[model samples]
Target: MEYVSVPTDIPDEQTPLLEVYDQIGPKSTFTQTTVNSLNLLMGMGLLSLPFAFYKLGWVLGLSLLVFFCMLACYTAYLIGKCMEFETGVGKLSSFYDIAYMAYGAPGKYFMVVLFSLELLAAAVAMLILFADSLISLVPVLTPFKPQIMIGSILLLTPLTWQKSMSKISWVSFVGVLSLIVLTVAILWDGITSPVGPGSIFDPQQTNMWPEDINQIGLGIGLLFVGLDGDQILNLGHAVFPSLYLDMIEKKRFGKSVSITYTIVAMFYSLIGACGYLMFGNEIQPEVSQNLPLVPSFNVLLNQSALSFIAINPLTKYALIVHPVNSTIEGLFNIYSDTLTILSRTFLSFLVLLIAIIFPSFYKVMGFIGAALSFMTVVIMPTACYIRLSWDSVSWWSRFAHSCIIVFGFGFMTFGTYGVMTV
Candidate 1:
């Protein structure tokens, strides 16, 4: 049996030892479906939900859904063009590769730097959310949160080290299952709960704030983080870049892209819409906390039961709580508090892992109104233009392009600091 390996560092000459490119291509039979499901599930996770819910409510959520539909439609069109080109000789694994192939070595380098920054920013945002969640869950844990986060990273690093891509994929698949189940349960409960006479479409009744225009704008800016093009771009390598091409050759590109994008858009929009209708301004930790007040889900039930067992006998009996005699929790807590220690360790690791891995915000979005904003915005379009029109490209066009990509780094240096402080 052949085995494939995904390098810790991308763009290296080391081909996977397996039949598939562990890093770039679908390795296991489970890769495609599992990864796709995870994509939607992660998109709808606790971290992303509440803010969207608070800002849009059900009405705007639907509007956002429509926007996603449009986005998918447009993306599918690009993918179709890519397929028509039959440009599958080279790897389209990362934005940089796509840019490099479409443009030149310079374009490739530009994309790498740009994407790396974006990933870093994303990582930071996740850390911020993780730290915030820890503080909310256990106030006393606040003082040690940062330490725990860092420590957890050290611990997890070894476990994740030398692990195969398939392993990572499967583990992520399992984690996503838990997250999705929790989210769906929460949303279902929220939808069933009673609501006032006002329509979910009504902004005023939905607790939306048209009064805070700046806030709305900020919310839109933040949405860009979630609507990131990286995920789609990543699909280029994992799936056939020629997937659209193959379909097109078979006269199926149009239908395939259309159906796929529509499905993805509708799914996310539905999740977001449901969550928004249920939780409004009070929504903060979008993915995790915004569920309905009813505590029926396992995680919620477990927490409630634990709380009840501590406070009152009637509530404990209602939950049918039984004290552990020699369980893991008991053994650990009997002599030392395992949950607290483990929680601290786990939360700390996630915070640091996210901070380091995801790119900075400015790197992802680039400066608004900048001429080179096009660089960060459209990978394929810019690459295609550069490739086909390199020599005949206008002097101004070249100048503008250079400015757009260059100024982004300068902006990131300053913008990152600003973001951290703010």
Candidate 2:
């Protein structure tokens, strides 16, 4: 496997998560895990909150965001719990390891496929966001959208070649700062806009619920996508195992999940509500673009915010593709760095091709969150926990897990079908 092997001479203070797996003691503390979890939760997922609210309206949108946040936290807790399960080899060390222990090799392989699909969907979403943002920033380059996305493939392909967490660890900070800048800029613009405070409690163009009752499924799906950490099996799921293992008190990871996800839910609510209020029915899928959509009196201000938002996806692109590259390498046994880089380059072009084919930011992300991520985050963790701890789990616990799985399926099915038809 092409693990992000750290250099022996690297500074202890700058050591990345993957470096200390076998270290004497846990290198990460509870506070550190919570912060890392928050960083992981707050990525590109925020970009689509307004678009989701526009589809489902305020009532369902906010409600679903809260609901999914709790669900994600719970499923994430299950992941940490599954980590304690003995696999004959030792405790689980990774998310897929949970599958391998619970359901054996078949389960492990299924996880690999699902995890890959989740990454593929996420990579495509990033490209769409990248392409869409580029178009918004420079419309004259509009006709060159395809070429721009292709160019992104070339530019970002090299970042994927760096096979160490220390190299990409700094990206978490960039992602957090950029997202904060974009969110603050939007909020500031919205409050100062002529729209007034009324947009807060009640917006003119936004809805409390879907305009048509039949479209509820689509709205729910978009909400699911919005929770995709995205920038995770949308970032939360992808990084959970690493953070969990690195924790000083592993059992307490659930509390970290709760705190991190709630904060993220608040962030999503703030941005989603603010964006929908400002744009109302006219909102675009990427919320940052919506900031300048208004007869923005602040061209320089809005453009700077967009400039900040633009850097985030690129910073996250390689990290997002890292797992996908690693997965393909493991399957094909491509151990050499040369073959690894070649395979990653091929994967980048493949991602670009997929992005071109399914270009709607809203549709693609919604499908991924509902269909692919629903499996990785909601379904798999719950199932693995039940299987791994079936004998000890209470009947009520089983009932709750079953209920979550069943309830989520309704929306997952509806969301996937809705995006597919579009």
Candidate 3:
């Protein structure tokens, strides 16, 4: 295991590690990488943004969205910088790889466990979304929610067996477009519909601050789940190194990351604000559910939203679970195609089982965001940066890193309690 070892000598910009990364093959162009990052950043999580906004009140919600977006970008930047450290022959490519490089065997084990759990939790949430959407769209499936979930697992199991991302990239693109359409529909509906007296966007409604302390805490947890891309398993902070390595123009990798997050943040703000303004406190966990269901134009929007919700998860389910499957194969040294299929099938079934047992989408999201996202997006990167740069960096840099770590832990603690109690 080649870890990014600590250097006795100060590493300048022209270090051998930097030179090695420069020599590596660039498999993706800047545009391709940016699109991929955007896709990963915006997923089913967008569906929960409205509820998060309503919980926190409009002003606080928007502020938190911007804050978290900047935090996510900064943490990713730190991961990129840390990956430039000496890791023997090759560069540290994944979140687990960086963890191992930074903290050896213990860190590797911890990251593997966290990453696997996060992936599994995400898969479970997707299945829950699938079953809920199906039941909502097709009334006949209402009583058969359990069966629908089981069927979804069976349908997605084969797709997971396909080992290449390129095969599913088109479907991923369609999924992204579906979300965009959903966002447009939500915005359109919110603007056209009559605002109720208690609507958050209404002038008569209470301004700015949330009156309920409990709701604010819970909202923070839910907002973290909605806005934080780190909960997406394979493509969070872990993805920076791979993106950096794949870029045709290595120098522009940082700029690309910033652009990707900025675009994603804008989308989140739009959806969250629109959805919350439309429904206020009555907002559902999934924004699609909040849309009016009638026999007119609203019906068309409702069906479109539900259809996309149902289809999008199925399309991205395989890719979402890919990291865990690959990790298992690597751990057990299983190279056989047949075994790989079996492993994916079993894992998919397990995730479906969990979904069936705990079908609360927002709750699951809050739990995952608090437990896993906080560590991956905040704590891990800060810890690694401090470990690698402690002796060489300034006191102010160390103090800033320490504050981030503390903030991560504090938020995680508050989020966990909020989710559990709410």
Candidate 4:
């Protein structure tokens, strides 16, 4: 509950810009932090929920969604506790900082690898999704062959080169607005569209449950991926740590996070439940593809969805590329603006190339969600909590943490296999 002030003695050049911001920038109110957290968690993940729900059946689907939401909230709280554990020495500015404190250099190295891989995969997935969405929005681009990837890279390269999170925060706001519009559009369509015979809400629908274990496993993986918003784990632009550091009343940080997650969970539930109920088994991986395109209102809804899909990724491109940029800069000790621009440009180009090579959007999301998200969101936090509070906490807490670790590994293994095979 105690608010820590930034040490003024550190040299400006030695301090990270983010650290500097924490020191001098105006602190955000609880409301602002809540909004930022909401923006961070909401994204393209919502679009895939209906397909995930369809695979699992309504009962199991909603149950897992709520389960994961609570799990994510708990792990996030564990992260805060871990940060508190290290607060006396200095501020834990990022997840890597907490990792380093928990298990020394090896822990730091492990987090770096997991985060770097996850961000790279996410960026590749975003690029592929953007290209696919653009093609869906404008059928004429189909003839151009790879025009989407090329155009996206060219347009986004300069934007990614911008080095300041403050500079990019506006784009993040725009991305948030896009997500809000997209969410409303999807919900509106779900409400207005006539339910078919196979609707999940209709008793006449058959095969309500998953046909096999494989389908259930895939559904679980997709659901995890759909809920993961930890792309904010990138140290260069992490949301939770920033929110914690920026809170006007540090004691209320937990309350703010709880409110934000609750709102996000509600949004996910509505989108998943309503979308699945509307389309039943007919829903596409990307719900936008399943939206009606003929009626004038429907056409507007479709465009809004497509526009969000296009802009969200582009706005997020920089945040995704930031860790890579920071890594290269730190490794080579290169701090010049020219080098920063060149590095980001090269990273953007590489992401574009990879996206072109492998254009499976939802599949990639499934892989990352199942393989990496569990580790970052569940395993790591729970392990750290156990390590930091082994003697201080109750024995039951340790057992719960152990179970979570086992569940995380099991889910990752089975989920990855399901995604690969299916």
Instruction: Give the top-scoring candidate (TM-score).
Output: 2
**Worst 10-residue lDDT window, candidate 4:** 197-206
Model 1, C-alpha of 205: deviation from truth (Å): 4.6
- What does the lDDT come to for candidate 1? 0.40
**Model 2: residues with Cα > 4 Å off, grouped in runs:** 1-26, 158-172, 196-202, 232-234, 336-342
Q: Report the lDDT of model 4 for residue 113.
A: 78
- Runs in model 4 deviating more than 4 A are 1-25, 28-31, 86-91, 143-145, 162-169, 194-207, 230-238, 292-297, 334-345
Cα RMSD for candidates in order = 12.6, 5.4, 5.9, 4.3
Per-residue lDDT tens digits for candidate 3, residues 368-405, read: 88777888888998898898778889999999999999
lDDT (tens digit, per residue) of candidate 4 on 1-422: 23457666765554554455556556888888788777667766677888888778877888888888888777777777776664444557667787777788999889877877888888888787787777778867766537777888898788777667677766666656666787777666555545452233342242356756677767877788755674533321234766776666667777877887788778889888767776666777877666643252367767977877777788788788787777767877878998888877888888878777767777777787788888888888788778878889898988988999898899888888888887
Q: lDDT per model, in order? A: 0.40, 0.76, 0.76, 0.73
- Which is the better candidate, 1 or 4, if ranked by TM-score? 4
Candidate 4: lDDT of 417? 89
Expressed as tens digits, the lDDT of each residue in 1-422 for candidate 2 is 11334445644544443334645453678898898787666666767778888888788888888988898888988888887776544567787778888899999999888878877778888777887887878878878878988888889999889777577767656666777778777767766666532244446566776887655665666777655565332445756998888787777898988988888888788888887887788778777766555664467777877776677678778877888888889889999989988999998989899889888888777777778778777887888888888899899988898887887787688778777775
What TM-scores do the predictions have?
0.57, 0.87, 0.85, 0.84
Candidate 1, residue 110: how far the Cα is off, in Å: 1.8
Worst 10 residues of 2 by lDDT: 1-10
Model 3 clashing residue pairs (backbone): none
TM-score, cand. 3 = 0.85
Write candidate 1's Cα lDDT for 220-287 as tens digits. Answer: 33333333332211222213333422221324455554555566555566555555554555444344
